[model samples]
Target: MAIVTMIRRDVLTLPAAELGPDNPLPPLRPLDEMHRIEDRDKEDLPGDMARQIGYAPLHSLLPVRVRDGYGRTRAPRDIDTLVIENDRLRATVLPGLGGRIASLYHKPTGRELLYRNPVFQPACFALNGAWYSGGIEWNIGATGHTTLSCSPLHAARVTAPDGGEMLRLWEWERLRDLPFQVDLWLPEGSDFLYVGVRVRNPHERPAPVYWWSNIAVPEECRVLAPAEEAYHFGYERRLRRVPVPSYDAVDRTYPLNSVHPADYFYEVPDGRRRWIAALDENGHGLVQTSTDVLRGRKLFVWGTGTGGRRWQEWLTEPGTGGYCEIQAGLARTQLEHVRLDAESEVSWLEAYGPLSARREGEWAAVVRGAEAGLDAVLPRAEVEAAYAAWRPCADTEPGETLAVGSGWGALEVLRTGDKLPGTPFEESTLGDAQTPWLQLLRSGSFPEPRRVTPSGETLVAPHWRDMLESAPAQPLTEYHLGVAQWHAGDRAQAVRSWERALQLSTSSWRLLRCLAVADREADHHERAADRYAEAFDDLCQERRDDGESWTAATAALGHEAIEALVATGRITDARAVWHRLHPATRRRGRFRLIEARLLLAEGKREAARAVFDAGFEVADLREGAESIGELWARITDEPLPAHYDFRMRPGHDDRPA
Candidate 1:
């Protein structure tokens, strides 16, 4: 019998703002209006005619006129929500909000595993500049919350092969022109929620993408993962190793009441198996596990501070209390980008459910219990007896012993099989089936071109070319082929291969950026400038039309366009482009330095000084402060004072210390 139900209800939500040509905000210039430069030559105009026509700013302070609201108000709207329940677990999903897992409840304990927001409140957090805290958010594409999180998704209720009910939610990511779908299944009497995610690139080109599952929990909850060390980004954005749970004079194993926020990406010690958990003070919480595909586990702490609290409240409903995220990624880390080839799809299964342990050692006992409990559900005697009674067949494997032990692990093992050489299964096959290619891609150890010596002559391996020819439509194949060609000293052929790949699909901003670099190297100044401009425009347009806020790609393309314009001696055009960039991108010290350079070129000495001062203030917040300072000295031919402190300043006395 089906254990899940789908229904529509008029849930209370904060209304989205309606801003466009029909309804616009009053015209009011920003404080820095004098610094803004108009696109006199129409060089900054969007290449797409549809976007250029009837486009005007509704608010001077905002770059995109059509933006969602950032306010708390009571409004009732119909939303499709899916309810899945077993004897011990009850969960809810909101299809309208990117099919978010709105609530997860443990019926026996009468506790909510996920922090449920009382009302919908969007804040300037996600990559789309609007994110709501709580539940589990499926983020795909580039880093940060995906563009689809706030948008409506297509959902359907289907029957699993085992006759269980499943809710499948899917959407086409317009920004990258990729399609992603998540299938949520709850067996008739299982305690866990089985999540199967698949992301596909239908075009005949490779795309660099990222995927993360952000699971939210209360601030008091502590995260546990099978990792000896965690990576912390230094001031220069370079990752450095720190002890797991406790490092840098801070205890990360157990949640602390510190005012300083922290974000860490933990490397799973055993790359073969990956799992993460969050336990509350009572040692009751949820554990998520995946055998393959999802490898990276991350912990994000907001800390107890007035600013962080305010931001947390803004993201959710006020008085909901603060929460943190336990994130899992398909790549090694969120900072790492993976390539998905044309007509290729990566799929994986993740299971999350309630877990409990005695409160005696707090986190120590909780971790031990979770580790011991992962592959066991019934008593050990019962599991052993069941295993003995089971018949062995050609497909029988040692890992199949998990079937009689833990329900969750059994499903995963049966679906994927034991890790060994020359398994009957082929890796190239796609869909819900488990494949070795998915495992390789998830491990972030996909094969690369190797140098080989044949007939006393060093040559690039033919394996890369063979793969490309076999999957000519695959984007990664073309990209790798180009890399091989470049390494073989065939620069022109490499550029042609990349250009052809771009023609197949223009979704990869990285590929576009690389092509532009090749153009610059070839002394094609005009072509390089044009390519940079197109890349920048595409990134900005995605933010404007698809609600995909600024990302690393956006920052890189913005800088590339600025530098290309400066190289072409189009100073005014560069200034205009800089001003039109997303506000978040403009806040970066690197972009601020670019702005300062433009001001200096225009002989605005005082304005340039003011820009440099502003950049210095925020430099400590990001890495590359020392580099920025060095660049400043070189630009103005003046050394910085020795006494200047580049570290982050303390918060106000009124805030948490």
Candidate 2:
């Protein structure tokens, strides 16, 4: 019953590219067919996805196919429903219109929780459970459907966001190295056992519906989305799965059975895609989901506690207990994608089993062409090697929205959603509560974890801080409060909170980036540069199957900053700061235009020109860069242009400049 909203920070509509044309580039190798499909433009325009476009599930143009030169198609299996039964529980997977698990009926207690893993953070379900209670995990919203599973094949339920019939089953099929073919494993005990629904577009114009699988799960879970690194809420983790953080009763208390402090918010490189697999404590399989398929995917690991860990707690509702869900993807899509076109069909796959589902000792899922088999085992080395070729975008790109200098300086804006370029908080604010406490925290105070006395009174302010200091400050709470403070306008306070947070938590690249940004904002350029550099080092250390692009991007940003200082004729300052920065932070987009300016300053006019010529005009100068309107005076050498209009930035409108 949650409202999910997708801000198309990176949403892009790619025009369909003609396929099957003879010999454009060297003919794609017959063995590398998957690569060809990826290169091909999507049939459905990859437009900016936002709130659910329509109630119906999203579909594709035609049945995706996977063709191996050897006459093999790595397609996923079709199933009516994948039932996972064991001593403790029973659940089923039904594929439907959207590639998701239709229903999750916890038979042990007759309590059914329907959700998806839009972004794969644990503590998904039982938000109102009787265990840990806090709004930490409530950062995301529920969309049309949520998929569930411990393997490549997912189980999901397609629900009516507007309170109508809410149930459907689905799974995704993929040929080894090809796009996925979603297979609807029709629901059981219902009329949709084998029949797939072809949803029609109800509105005349395209509608944008926010949809994502709200995967509900316990607090003691972790993810493996291979990216530069994974962040919870905004905190990062070191390991994919770690022990749950202990609940510090002295900090601010939330609802029991809730994921507080740390909420998994996986940061994937733009245009990169891949699947994330989740495992339990015993290293046994638990759940896995994927990001977009075109770019090589990466894993985002998130949890609570020191390092990357989760806070162990039980999920008990009015009657049920110990349940959770994971969410994945942005919440919205254009109505066109949701309303099934007459000839369009959407497909995916879902498979599940107890901890002992697969006994062959193979511990991974393969994503390829349409053909996907649960029991299929290809060379693990080959999978990693093939995927490793692709790199991810840097996580430090300008916020989602970007407005480069138009060809004519026409003030052109390419907007997907309301987020500013290079901003990450836009997505993190999704489902977070606008509570006064949260509001105050967002403003400046980094609230420590809640503390409850023996009599059970929630602590706040001085008392909360006292409790946090008395015991170990919960990393998640500290980070959440720090972010809250940052949003609330106390940049200095937020920086302090994050510094304290870093002491207890380790292994989050995003946090490292945040620390860098926070220090920069405070004009502590040396510290910020150092932090960014450290993030790059950590990124290199945690290099997984995917995510080099983002790492590169981070480095790019740092370098950009240095380049900017140098361009503005501050070489000595730039060099001093650059030296202080870690090698990783010095590599990529850290200072995009700033670098160009620096090159210009150093009299490397051609190099500077190259930097500018390489789509530098298109560079997102909005992040710390002065806005066009702000720069008008400088550029015009006169009063503001008469035709120019100005307004404050979205979230900063009311704040002082």
Number of the top TM-score candidate: 1
TM-score of 2: 0.26
Q: Write the per-residue lDDT of candidate 2 for residues 1-657, one digit (tens) a residue.
A: 222311111121211111111110111112110001111222332333221222333221111111101101112333343442333333343321122343444433453333222221112122110111211111111121121111122222222222122222212111110112122222222111121221112222443222233344433333334343332221211112121221222111111323222333344456443343333444333333332331222222222221122122211122222333444443221121233233232222222221212212211231121013212422223233322321111112332121111010010011112221111222222222223233233343433334310011112223234333344355655654455455435667766767776788654554566677666655667666666556655644554432333433334434534633543455756655555444533332324344555554566667755553353221112111234344333323454332222221222122211
Tell how far residue 3 is off in model 2, in angstroms.
Answer: 37
Model 1 / residue 133 / CA error / Å: 1.5
Instruction: Write down the lDDT that model 2 would get.
Output: 0.30
What TM value does model 1 have?
A: 0.53
Error of 2 at 485 (Å): 4.0
Relative to the unseen true structure, what is the C-alpha lDDT of residue 304 in candidate 1, on a scale of 0 to 100?
58
TM-scores across all candidates? 0.53, 0.26
Error of 2 at 73 (Å): 24
Error of 1 at 117 (Å): 1.8
lDDT, candidate 2, at 72? 11
